[model samples]
Target: MAIDWIGFSYAATLALGGVLGYTRKGSIVSLIAGLFFGALAGYGAYCVTCDPRDVKISLYAAFILATVMGIRYRRSRKLMPAGMIAFLSVVMILRLILSLL
Candidate 1:
């Protein structure tokens, strides 16, 4: 099976964000939200890369979610989640921009 590193990284970052969010916030809601959003974004990355039909919508949603989470983390003064999500969001945004070229 071919390894999808981009997809893996996307998923990992989101999942990590969730874990960190839960750890930092000490709330189950953060955990659930993180996992849900991570899975959604990871699936989006998979669809965008593998599917021939433009799955750009998913990428947009993922980006938005990531950005929101990143801001949340930042506001909470949690460095890891904030930094991870911020970087991941930027990378995804760059990838989306490049795909347009």
Candidate 2:
């Protein structure tokens, strides 16, 4: 069941890419990043859930990674402008759930 997320991730990314291209005037890369961000968010959430006290470090790491990716690719089309915020939010939320575990 949990493993199904991988397939869902790919499909969702492709679907979002198509939607953005057709409606939001976004490029395929945006969709790809959105999907990638979502997956990253999920992974981050998973990580912090394993250790709540380490959330600060995990979050900082994620931010650094995001910054690096942004610097490496100047094209906004390859990334969702605010996806990092969304990704962080989701990761935090997931971490909260993991904390209760």
**TM-score on alpha carbons, each prediction:** 0.69, 0.39
Regions of candidate 2 where Cα sits further than 4 Å from its true position: 1-23, 54-61, 64-101
Instruction: Give candidate 1's total backbone clashes.
Output: 0
C-alpha local distance difference test of each model: 0.68, 0.48
- Model 2 residue 80 lDDT score: 56
Model 2 per-residue lDDT tens digits across residues 1-101: 12324323433553464456546774666566556655554555455455544445435434654465455446554445344433544454454446456
User: Tens digit of lDDT per residue, candidate 1, span 1-101?
Assistant: 33446755776766776787678878787688778767877777676667624547556755786678678787887756566677777776777667657
Instruction: State the local distance difference test value for candidate 1.
Output: 0.68
Best candidate, lDDT-wise?
Answer: 1
